[model samples]
Target chain A: MTPVPDPSEEWRRLDRRTVLVTAAVLTGVAGGAGLPTVLGLAGAMPLWRAVTWVLAGAALLVGGGAAADYVRWRRTRYRVGAERAELRTGLLLVKRRSLARERIRSVDLTAHPLLRVLGLVKVRIGTGENAGGESTLELDPVTKAEGERLRRELLDRVRPDAPDSPHDGALAVLDPGWIRYAPASFVAPLLGGAAAGAVMQVSEWFGAQGEVIEWIGDRFQDTSVLGMIVVLVLLALLAGTVGALGLWVEMWWNYRLEREPGGTLRVRRGLFTARSISIEERRLRGVELVEPLGVRMCRAARVDAVATGLVKDDEDKHADHKTLLPPAPRDLADRVAAQVLRESEAPTGAPLTAHPRAARTRRLRWALGSALAPVAVLAVLGAALTPVLLYAAAGCALVLVPLAVLLALDAYRNLGHGITGDYLVTRSGTVRRTTVALQRGGVIGWTVKQSSFQRRAGVLTLTATTAAGEGAYDIHDAGEGEGLAFAAEAVPDLLAPFLKPTGVRDAGVETRKTRG
Target chain B: MTGENAIRDEVRLRPPRNAVDERAVTWWRTQLLLTTTVPVVVLGVLGALLQPARFWLLLTAGAVAVAGLAATAFFPAWWFRVHRWEVTEDAVYVRTGAFWQEWRIAPMSRIQTVDTVRGPLEQFFRLSTVTVTTASSKGAIRIEGLDHQLAADLAERLTRITQDTPGDAT
Candidate 1:
């Protein structure tokens, strides 16, 4: 079905609801600005006068903003033509932007809580150029239905002769059971810490700091310090769990991944602030299965699309909009990845070849060294300061040593690399394990690095440099001979011309001997 | 013997020779001297005015300035000798660095943009710097100290090559 609107139609303005949103926003700003004055005048001035002043301030701000917004809404106009999508905006400067239909890569729609209530959404049409904001055209407060129609019309450029078309069906949808994994994420502890800090900060602000501390101390009066500490930790954890669950629900309440008509993979999600992201099938390279330490322990993983032109707009948001599936069962993540790639088998699930033993040794030494540095510093400080510091140093070492060893072992276990069919899979890390299944053809070059230590150990780091995804996938500490051979085999003739006949030594004995 | 050993042996040998402009040494020395002189002069004047007792500091500063100027005059010539770039049909090779040498090879097809930049100092010297930007996160590779005409010609040639080759879907 043709999704294009009538070409004869004139440039249309945004939804009328934007005026109300602007008024509401201005009222909020006025209230925030006048709060201090209201509180200061609470005692000296008459109550009605104070109220009148606040009301007048709010009314004036809202009236001015609403009038300006009305003018802006009147001036701003957008037209979706057969060849280009044009947006003419700016009150005085008269900035006009038009993106060619063929160059449009993605059409993303976002609706905040207010916009959602008003049935309006902001649409950002991108050309996938890395030229910052210049490559995108924003249409704020468009009707939800109009936004959807625009998305479909702009992205309906599927190849006619394609053998296997994109499956026009829901690939993945949110499962309520996945919410259990939400609190299990790293964000839980962070939220817990933030909650603890907020409590202290708020108490201090209200001049009730002593009362709160005294109450806390009284509750733990009969208990030992250790017991009280444990209780506080548990309380923080509980608070964190609730915050994480609430955040998860807000972000992924009705998350749905669907293959829309015309080879577009669209994700519609969020509860209060709904988001619709469309990724063209042709730009997709592969999928990444990320399993953080906590998530991996729970056998849950998140899936991200490794596609070109999916540049992250915000550094603060984890996973950004590239997340295909929230933290779920590893098997489910793999299945969703397979669906995204339109392949029978998920490339990430395959057993990858392990790196040499020397690599593990190197990791262990580094981890141990890192863990010991702090301990050594504490010991030195203890020696210089007091005997009490020695106890703290001992306590630190007692906790850190084992944890460091475990992480080192985990990192070693996670290190592996393999090539399966048209994809090369590389897995690494301990705290945040990532298994990337990258397209072999996407790789532009191979970088081989051998530090003085690595060279002595007869190992090198081989990086498959690509423009898409994380820019580069590295197979760390592969035996020198094996890495070169792998590089040569992966790209055939690319590395062969540089390699000498003497370089192709067997991987096992030399790496082992060098470590000894 | 393994193939990797042969490759490593070849890499150890000097790469292809395509030296930068000879005047680059004088240009670099002048730039270095100019940068160093201001800071040295400022420190010396501040010391002389603010703390007359620390006049020994001024002597030390003068000595450092002399040493810096001497190094600046000598180091650029060595740097100029080391800096080299070669553009082949398939790839562009650039070798640079003073203490820790770096050799970068970017495939011709990976190049997205080629630009020629000339600063006021470079304009005075009739020299230009050519930058080849690839899609790689490693950032652009710059080949400085080329004759103005040569830089423009190289930029044009690289642009033409990039256009002719189909860009990788990145």
Candidate 2:
């Protein structure tokens, strides 16, 4: 028999420099963790003794981490075979997992600052299944060139006869002027709140809480309590603005949206950490125009792609892989959205059919109920316990009632739905109004819901079930006949077989049927 | 006149044509009995052992048991009347829930997988639950309490039909 070539020879090891990267990372981690430990220990014991203990612990931690990573690197072997990309990892358990080559949908490349310096990138091969980590193959710290090659090899299924579209190249790029919109976002207030909390927490950590409080009290001693509070709030807001600006830059620096040759839209961004996220144009169902309250006031909107298989990883829940463009001018957003979907005009910008008046009444009721709930609670407590709470309750109602009513009216006004060629569009929400244009063809199912109360009101909610995006987008509180008709028209035969044309019957029967 | 005309032409979603196997009512009763009474009984025993003098806790447990028993007696039959499933050549239709009613329709062309699941109780009752999954996360239609053999055949048939159909089912 001919000598059988070793099967293990075909298996490739992870980069040898992974050990170095691991060591460096471990050192950084040790330093970060050791400082706090040393500080805490220094108070309990002598400073030099604490320092020496921490240094020894840090060395041990780094050594242990590097050794573990070295063992992991030695054990981990991956092979991109003819049919499957297989990875065999773990020491004792020896977990062997494989993903079919054809099923692979994305090959993202990311490089943090350290990885960038080392000329290495992490390659994440995903099947785009919502099935957690099982469907992903992660090769950490692969050479940048290797990552690029792997990405190309996996995603190189371009149709030979694909027509060259006019908008095939760079679709959009970062504009420095966009930073002006950063502070206008809700992030500013959130960051400001976080900054205030952090200041208190950090001062407490350093045992300087009392001193900081005294200093603040001294600074504001000249002013009245109200004026002091106002100044402090303004200062916090200024700090928040700066923080939000920095965060925005770090997140969206060098942002570029490009439509590649093989019908893929690639988004490349980040400053210290580079990310290359690719979305196959075929998987794109539609686009959403998101206008948050503050952003809306500034006449700007963000465009997000509605694509299948863009599930967030369990480990990286905050990673938003759907956004194609940040908050920009509304007209520019519409234009970019149109270009992204390859339509003459953005479907999201199309005039929508306004929801019925009863829908508005329902929202008003809900808003009034919500606004009244806390006041009612306070009033009850005041009657039972203290009279001061009654005054508080009244004050709250004065401020909250009109605000709730305004919001209710805005929400009611925002409710709309319509069909625009191949896309069925729906818009809703007030604080964060979202206009979704979903591909009519992408809808695979429909769910129609009607509560007993809704039956009385002659309204229903129609949910278009799609494989893409949030899976289901609702047309809420529409006239029963109108909603059903819309569903029937949106997807031809899906809902037709279930519907029966009948003369208006007794409402009692319908309610009883629902209850039963 | 046009508004009235639109209302006149409107169609309402009727319940799906088929009801599940009748055994589902008994199966649901048994399941609910186990789920509800187990906790109440455990709490009653623990209360009696730990604090024999605290009579109100035992009374509370007794009240919960009575409520659970009432629900076990009536809810299943009501649910049996409401829950429905019908598979056509084009789509799978289902109507489910009691107070907040819902009608779901999933097209065959978009169906991703079909499975027959038999839990311990279902197996004991010789029943099966046929789960029809579409690409959409919200579009998994479960037809509970079908005859085991019938569910298997349905699952097999669906698998064959879906295999013949093209596209990524997205």
Candidate 3:
């Protein structure tokens, strides 16, 4: 996307980038220093010093990055003199991407605690006449007044008091500290990243008999041979844990599951970083109320979507990309689902026919058992991994075994989603709860699958695809009989438009009721 | 009037059809033979290089390689599967996929862009393939099975269809 050339626009844009660079550089240097300090204790100090000196030299080279960013940022300004919001930015290589006022879809304002204190808010404006190309363009943090002005200017035609968008809804509840500080959330990351950082810090120790460290250090530059290998492995694990925490934290805060006053419903969440999103009311996608029997006992169900992008933490299916919320409260899930789905009742279709009693669920145990088999397989995967496990020490192995088991148990949960008529709602999640509000209009297609095993168990899995693109937003698992029935029967009713070569719908047609 | 007539001439000149990169089919067949079979063959011959002493251990990698190689044999067939595209009154469906079914359907209305691409291999083959990416998902639905001239003709047809805008959702 190009931005127009405003005289000095580059400098202003770079200024914003420069500040972020400063923050990153400061964090990296500080974060890097901690590593060497710890590695010194691991009996590799002398070698570590040499490795650090090289790194410190490299950091010096990038010292001007922050300054460069500042220059670029200071030069940028929105030339809103007339018909367009001329976004002129970039430095050495310039770009100008302009979005006319008429193209504005919605204006969203977001602020973190830091941004709030700075009296600045970041705004994202969704535009583009169709789903193609940049759906949203970001505006650098602006003061509240400027943000309001921009909002007013762009959305002049839209109802100012729409009241039911993602930003303004009864469901937009800020999370309390208790949910944020959940022991599972903090303990895992603290133990993981800190222990890893601590372990690496010792690996660079340049102390007595450091010749081996010297040899490895001398082998690679731009990287110490040992440091690079060790740090990269740690980073991989760290990244994975970071991702898991991201999902955990995102579910914890700004966790709003609301039925907007407008016919659409949205579930917006994030912990440190948040997202403000609104779906087209008529574009509610196919949904599933999955009851992973194991997570059910724990009262947790993961509600993801069949979205097109690469996230939302469910297994990658075009149908199930975004996890609607971590886990939310039942009463709240119902209210939000009812509103979004236009259902008279909130979605509560858990294994209603099969397991009449909630407490006595074997499915939870069954799901847990299958999930745990992978752990055993991983453990038995020894030949390729013997060196790694041998370092654990036998006693630690005994303790680690039980921890994995307990966590697996906690993950067991049961949930379901059903589309009674035109509206589709799903109930899921354990520790936190989630219910998705989907409609026939949002979905693009239907999919039905039944394993020979499922037929024997009187189960059928249904996956519904939506126009949301890839991942779970496209497909999701549902209870067998009900799921397939919904797929072959209910889905055709919902997505009948796409099925026709000509997408023109019959006039005066309302939503078709659930054939299921 | 002059520009319109010239464009009309170019449109009419587009050939009816052409075929996908036969070289791509040939190259894949060889790559399949090497990566899939080479390692297993080496492991089978060497004791230390072999997998565990379990009953089917030696055969496991080799078995997987064989299945993979078998699948690779059909790579060209799979990759160049879409030689036929009939835009019907009902819908546009292209049959692809090896095991699980893949029938890409793009109604005339949702068609966004009609493009042609030639990867390095296809360039060598003097082949340009057509891509009909719709507003459905992420990437466009590409039909590489078309012959080069046919690809150009189909692209023009698609472009014309999109331009017509039939008024009532096409």
Q: Summarize candidate 1's per-residue lDDT along A1-516 as a digit string, tens digits.
A: 124365424577788788999998788888776775676566679977988888897888899999999998888989888778899988889999998888898999998888888888888899866665888888888889889888888998867855355445899999999998998888898999999998987676556778999999999999999999999999999999999999999889899999876888999899888988899887777788999888998999999987777746673384277888999999999988888888778888988777777888999999889989999999999999998889988998999999999999999999887777678788999999999988877776665566667767667777777776676778888766666666666665455555554532344334321110
For candidate 2, lDDT tens digit of each residue in A1-516? 122365323687777778888889989998888877887888999999999999999899889988999999989988787688888999999999899988887888888888999899988888867786889899987789878877877777867777467778998998888888899888898889999998998787677889999999999888999998999899899999999899888778999999888778888988888888888887899999999998999999999999888747555432467889988999989989988998888888988877777789899999999999999999999999999999999999999999999999999999988888889899999999999999999999998888888777778888999988898998888778767877788888888878887775434323211000
Lowest-scoring 10 consecutive residues by lDDT in candidate 3 chain A? A351-360
- DockQ, per model, reads 0.23, 0.47, 0.05
- Cα-based TM-score, every candidate: 0.86, 0.91, 0.56
| CAPRI quality of model 3 | incorrect
lDDT of 2 by residue, B1-170 (tens): 33423463357888887888899899999998898888888778878787755587688788888888999998899899999988888888988888888888899899999989999999999999999999998888888888898899889988888888998899
Off by over 4 Å in 1: A1-9, A28-37, A40-50, A163-168, A201-210, A224-227, A315-319, A446-450, A492-516, B1-45, B49-84, B95-103, B119-128, B137-139, B145-150, B167-169
Interface quality of candidate 2 as DockQ: 0.47
* Top-TM-score candidate index: 2
Per-residue accuracy of model 3 over A1-516 as CA lDDT, tens digit each: 244575223322311433664556565675666555545444545766656765665466455665665765665655554466666667666667677765554565655545555556666666523443344556666665566566655555533455434434564364463242232333345556665665555643544235655664666567756778886567656664665455556545666655544433345555554444444333345333333433344343334433332223122121222444443443444444454444556554423222111212334555546655655555555436785544443444566556645543443333444555565554444443444445545444333333444434433334444445341232223443234334444445332332322222342222322233
Segments in model 3 whose C-alpha atoms lie over 4 Å from true places: A1-66, A80-83, A105-114, A126-136, A152-169, A172-326, A347-418, A424-437, A445-464, A469-516, B1-87, B103-108, B116-130, B136-144, B147-155, B162-170
Quality class of the docking in candidate 1, CAPRI style: acceptable
lDDT values for all models = 0.80, 0.85, 0.48
Model 2's lDDT to the true fold? Answer: 0.85
Comparing 2 and 3 on TM-score, the stronger one: 2
| Tens-digit lDDT track of model 1 for B114-133 | 99999999998999999987
TM-score (C-alpha, index-matched) for candidate 1? 0.86
